[model samples]
Target: MPPATPDAALTSATASPQQAAPDAQGGVVLAPVAETPPKRPRAPARERTIGTKVAGQPAFVLHSYPYKETSLIIDLFTRDFGRVALIAKGAKRPHSQLRGVLQTFQPLSSSWVGKSELRTLTDAEWVGGMLPLEKTALLCGFYLNELLVKLLARDDAHPALFDHYVSTLNQLAHNEPATIVLRKFERALLKETGVAADLGRCTSTRAPVQADVTYVVDPERGPRPERASDPWPRVAGKTLLDMEREDYQDAATQSQSKQLMRFLVAHHLNGAPLNTRQILVDLSQL
Candidate 1:
């Protein structure tokens, strides 16, 4: 028989070496070899990392408040990073570069670095293509910023919603109907956060909604036939479908969708009041 390879011989047995007696002619006798333990591999060394750094990202200042004596705590809405709280060191100082650069409603290219929930702002510069929001549009911009600060969680990326927000701002700046703009933004926010339901379908029937039927939207579920005891807003099926298509030209669609969206937003907020909403409501605006 062919001899076992050296590896096979070593692996096939774990017994101690046995001493063999000399042959009749007294030839040199070979002893069985004991198995040796396999060596363990050495682990690779870990790299020393300090923190994360993001640069030249699209962003906007949602809100800011004075921090310490010369710094500011800023709530920033970023295209890729969502809502982030940043400490803008020396931002409140009269001659600080960031003092003039960190205005709200302006597009910015920003850089930040940190490992914690709140980050350090490294640099920011205005992108400067968008027209400034003025008059009621300025208030509306603040309202949008408020919604983002309240609804979105830190470090959650919502690139699509961010784009929609820019578009909404542009529309509002150009004097488009504020009602339509606010409704669209509210719907997008709810849908992006997984809080919105399909308005064209009935939750109970598993079928398309009838345009003439009156329904109440369940916050956790979708739309269902209205009950007399239900406390939710009653919306006509046509209004729901119109909102689904984003067509608010009809007066009834406009009025009913306003109430429906308000109810849905309030439900998702869990009784938390929106300050900007109250201000607009007091002014008889959206």
Candidate 2:
């Protein structure tokens, strides 16, 4: 819950999408890439079911665990259906078709059929083309997955956030600054989850934030002038404004936003600890 200490707070996919390049204004911009549509599922008759089928759904495997003998319970982050739990029958079998298909950070077009909370995965195939995450980027990818698995609700849809997620992955794979990529995604995730508030103005006065003024962000509200007794992280108004514009060009914004987001995320989680966050903190990465 709050990273165990203030220092903990301070320590903090999709297709072959094109690399992200900064615009003339030096803002990161993702070039739109064409996505190859997923082919229809080809499965045995016995595996096919009519129970509310969703086919060719863009997705990534957030996490999976062994369920029974050779089976797995997969948590998927889908474009249209948010997070979903599916039973991957026989995935653990050596020759199972899904053995190579279900992997984290790899794009997939998943098909399933079921009305229950745990659906049956009928078919899945890797939608290749994107760069694979390596080294620190790989760990950062896991961190992103952890956040989605912990924060996003099942069956909820967040299309914009999903797109941004893809772009974030692309940036990370390209060796772009991890801190900036993560900060942007965290902000987007918080916004999509309906927790983030505008940081460009004061919650109390509704006046534009002055760059040099120090402020404290209220997770439930927005930013406000800091008081003597406030215990939250005190960030400069410039940091808040820079984060609002998704700009991390400034060194101060990078450091301050990290701590601010760490505190806010912990607040929203109601004191639940983020495992990957702790790992990143230990590694001095992120």
Candidate 3:
């Protein structure tokens, strides 16, 4: 059998032959000495961390408010970081670099740094490929931003939804029907947040929704069979399936889907009004 080797802990404590003393009987005995406890490996020296620095991330300014005399606190929807609040110092000053570049609905590559929920905006560069949303589309753009700010939690990234937002912006810029465009974005926003999904199925039965049957969206659940006295908007199951497919070209689908989505979003908001929606609705623009 191979001789057993001392553990590293024991090896560190082994005495030198010179340290052993001659006993009265002739055997060499080591004098008792305090055994050193194994040194706890010190945690590696922490690098002096200053702050979390993010650079050249794709984002859009959802909204910005005057933070103080010369600064603005911005609500930004970032592709990778979801919703973020950033303090753009000196942004309100006439000569400030961020004043023109921080416009809402414009795609921007922004850099920020800080450790708190509200970060410091270090830089912003416009990445202009899509056209600026104009006229009615412009209001619709603000509507989208309002919905996101209302629904999306900060620092929660929804990459798919972000891509959809960019696509919706492009579509709006190109003069796509606003009704369909807004409905699609609303549906997608809900789906991304797990507030709505499986729109083509029924909530109670978990069965495939029939095209001809009327239903009401439960918001928490998917869809429920419409009851006689139900006040919520009743939508045909076909309309629900059309929403699932993102198709709203048909007049009935277009009209019915709008009411359904409006109810669902309102339910989730718990009567909190969408400002942009109110503006568009007041003007009979949407």
Return the top candidate by TM-score.
Answer: 1
**Model 1 C-alpha lDDT versus the unseen true structure:** 0.90
Clash pairs, model 2 backbone = none
Model 2, range 172-269, lDDT digits (tens) per residue? 99999999999999999999999999999999999999999999999999999999999999999999999999899999999999999999999998
TM-score of 3: 0.83
lDDT of 3 by residue, 76-110 (tens): 99888889999999999999898899998889999
Models, CA RMSD each: 7.8, 25.6, 7.1
Worst 10 residues of 1 by lDDT: 42-51
Give one clash count per candidate, in the order shown.
Answer: 0, 0, 0
TM-score of 2: 0.82
lDDT of 1 by residue, 1-286 (tens): 9999988888767557666768779976868766789997754331112247788889999999999999999999998778888999999888999999999999999988888888999999999999999888888889999889888888788999999999999999999998889999999999999999999999998899999999999988999999999998899999999999999999999999999999988888878888888888877778
Error of 2 at 122 (Å): 0.3
Candidate lDDT values, in order: 0.90, 0.91, 0.88
